[model samples]
Every structure is written in C-alpha cells, then in structure tokens.
Target: MKKILVPFCLFLVTLAYSQDDLLKSLDSTQTEESYSTATFKALQLVTLQTTKMPAKKEFYFVVSHRFGTVKDGFDSFFGLDNATTKLGGIYGVTDWLAVSLSRHTLNKMYETGLKYRVARQNDNFPLDIVGYSVADINTFLEKDQYPGLEFKHRMTYVQQVLLSRKISEKFSLELVPSFIHKNLYNPDIERDNQFSFGGGGRYKITKRLSVNLEYMHNFDKPDFYKNPLSVGLDVETGGHVFQLIFTNSQSMSESGYLTNASGDWGKGDFFFGFNLYRVF
Candidate 1:
C-alpha cells in the first residue's frame, strides 16, 4: 500500500497538468504536455522490466527460453541440451495497465502479474515510472520428498518499481527496485524476504537492432550464490521483437533469478537464451 500511494498521486498530478486548464486568465491558449512514446521498444530489457505498456486493447503472445549453463562445454552441448521454457500472454486492459499469465518449466511455476504506467515522461518531466507485481506458485515440490509440505509452502510474490529515461534517440536506461517474499525457503541458503536492485539499458546500433545489458544485486544474498549478469541484442521485426540473450542464470522468473542464480560468470557458467514476442 505504501508503494501504491506515491505513484497513484503522481499519476493524478501528471494527468491534471497534461490538460488545458480553463483558468486561462493571462494566456489565451495553454500548451498540453504530451506523453513520451517508445522510451523502450519492449516491456522487458534483458532480465529487468521496463517502463513500457501495451496500448489499450492490444494483445501479445510471449515465448521465452533459457538454456543450461554453458560451462559444461560439449558434454552438455553448451547449454542447448538442457533448456527451460516459458509461455505467456499479455493483454492491455487500458492504456495505463496490462495483465499477464505465464507458465514456466522450472519448478513448474505458474505466474500472474500486472504492469501499469503510473507516470510518463513528458515535457519538463524527466522520468517514466511504472509499477509491476506478480505472484507465483511452485508446483514441482513433492509431498513424498518432504512429508511436511503444505499448500502455502509453494507461494512466492514479487513487486517492483520500474523507472526509466530516454536520454537520446539512441539510448535509454532503467533502474528497478524489487521486493520478493516466499512462504517457504531454506533459512541457510536465502532469506524468506529479499530485496534487489537492477540496472539495465539499451543502445541502438542500428534502426532494427540494439544492445542491451542488465545486472542485479541482491542485498541479502549468501556468498555462494552469485549475482546475475546478462547481455543481449534486441532485434525488432515488423510486428514482433526478438531478443538474443546471454546470462549467468537459467531461471527467467523474477524470484528465481534474483535469489537462486547459481552460475558464475567468472567460470563461464552462463546460459544462452532468447525471448520472442508477437503483438496484435
């Protein structure tokens, strides 16, 4: 609730100022501040969410895959032999909000999320702020393996604030502050509640292609679990976006990558992945 207040207030303020006021006593006409467009070409940059929302009534289908660690060399076929996939759909309920549902192969997780535009970058406004929240259920746990397993043990949730700025025609940057909660977790390996900060950006090298990079730091991560780092190339086609990515994490879900990334970049332990999105 604390996080929702500020953005909701800002949204009202921005919406108010963006219109022409009737109290034009001094000036004959008022200039309306229009919202910025295309700050980002996609809703996601690498592994972090961006301040982009689908247009009202628009719908999209998303397919994402993350391969196993490449450090195993030919034995594991450079991560190609072992892969995890996610299939999802996103629909814009209004210009300011969208809803999504997805299923992931890892732990057989089912996810549902909301993304909303709280504020936009317009004349005199320097930032685009958006909110994202999701809840997931890990269905892979077996009661036989853990006799005490319960329904509540499978739940996890994530909330994030996505802040972004389009600095120029060729570059855009984003910062994400995230919060995660898990009902069941190993105390020794990770915390039930975790916080992480993510930084990512995109630089257009050509009209149809751009380079993207993202890194996330967990404030409470244990020593052995490594932070995730990712780099990718974004390819824009007529009605779709294809992203080719390289990263030190195999799980694409928010809580999965943020807290459970096991691969180490130093040891060449990372996966090759791709995201394909089609909008209609």
Candidate 2:
C-alpha cells in the first residue's frame, strides 16, 4: 500500500494547475472580515491539526507516509527501507462537524476521531476554537509476548482543543492542548494520563504556498523520548494540498507523536514525509 499510495500522490502533483493560476483571485479579495477564510489551506499542518474543516457533506481522502531516520544516509536508502503509511478519510457531517477514520501501518493502528467547531473567530469571538476527540487501537500487541493481555490494553484515547487565530493576512497560529489516556502503559517510563502543549504556525509566502512549523512539548515523556518538531511546506492547488515535511516524529497518531516521538533533530534523527489531501 505504501508503494502504490506514495507514487499515486506524486502523480497527482503533476496534473495540478500551476500554483499561480489557482491564486489569481487572491489579491482581488482584500476586505477584512471578522470570520477569516483560508487561515490554513489544509486541514493539517505536518504532525498537527489545523482549524479547518470541509464543507457540509464534503469528503476528503488523506495519505501520509513517514520514512525511517535519515541519519543513516545511503546505508538505509535515506530511510526508504523502513517506511510507514497511513490512509484515512474524513467527512463533514455538517458545516461545523466532522468525523474521520484512519489506519496506520505502524503498530497496526486503527483510529477514529471527531472534530467540531465550537466557536469561530468572528467579530464577537477572539479565536477559532475546535474540539477533537479520538480513540485508537493497537492490534500489533501479541498475547504470546504478554501472558496477560486484554482488549483494553490496546486502547488509547486523546482529547485536544485547537485554538487558533489569523494574526495577519500572511500569518496564522494555533495552540493545541492535548490530553492523552492510555489504558495500559509502562509505569517505569510514563503515566497513563499525559498532557502535552503544542504550537504551530503557517507563514504564507505566496497565495498558493506557505511554510509551516510545529512543535510539541510533552510534560510527562521519558528522558529518551524527544519532543517532536516538524517543519514543512504546504502547496495548495485547487482541491489538493501537498505537504513536504521534515519531522522528528515517526508516529502519525496523536498519542504516539505526543509521547513516543523517538527522533532528535540535533543528531539528524528525523524523517522525511509527505501528506496528500484530496477533496472529493
């Protein structure tokens, strides 16, 4: 699936209209309104979620791929030898509510989540507030390895509140306060309930392109687990958003990235990945 999906994403890039053509009307609309539009072009920013949802009844398909640490250089084919893939679909049940389902190859993880826009950054509001609830199951755990494994041991849940603002015409910022619950975990390493604070920003360099940066600080992570930091570029072309990222995170799920990020940017321990979101 990784082989096919990765190539398919690249193929779509070739068929998209030039960036300039898609943003021709960008300058024509300069009226400042209380409710912002296109604060972030995509629904995601690297490893973080953005305060954007599809239109009512609209659907979106997303493909994400993360390669191994590039520190090995040519020894590991620049991380191509060990790659992980995630495939997901999202649907907006209403203009303010969305639900998503995803499967990640790592840990044989399956995740489902709901997003609701509780508040919009309008004249009466100061920010765009979105609430998220997600749950995931890890099917990779083996009963043989753990003599006493239960269904609950494989479960994890996450709750996050996304607060964001379009600071200016060319900049947008978001803050994510996340609460993670693990049904089973190692006491020696961490606790069952964990909290992390994350911040991300998008600086528009052009109407169709922007630079994004995200970082998360886990207050309860073990010493060995480094904070996840991701920097990427979002290329918007009509119904598709292509993201090219360099991140110190190997996991695509919220629980995984928040507490289990294993890479370190200082040592060049980072992965190269891309996320392709297509509107259907």
Against the unseen true structure, what C-alpha lDDT does each candidate score? 0.87, 0.88
Per-residue lDDT of model 2, residues 1-280, tens digit only: 3454466447435533333443353334434464777878899978888999888999999999999999999999999999999999999999899999999999999999999997666544456789999999999999998879999999999999898888999999998878899998999999999888778999999889999999988888899999889999999888899999999988999899888999988888999999999999
Count: clashes, candidate 1: 0
lDDT tens digits by residue: candidate 1, 109-140:
99999999876776545678899999999999
Q: Model 1 RMSD to the real structure?
A: 5.0
List of clashing residue pairs for candidate 2: none
Q: Report how far residue 216 has shifted in candidate 2, in Å.
A: 0.8
The TM-score, computed over Cα atoms with residue i paired to residue i, of candidate 1 is 0.88
Q: Which stretches of candidate 2 lie over 4 Å from their true place?
A: 1-34
In terms of lDDT, model 2 sits at 0.88
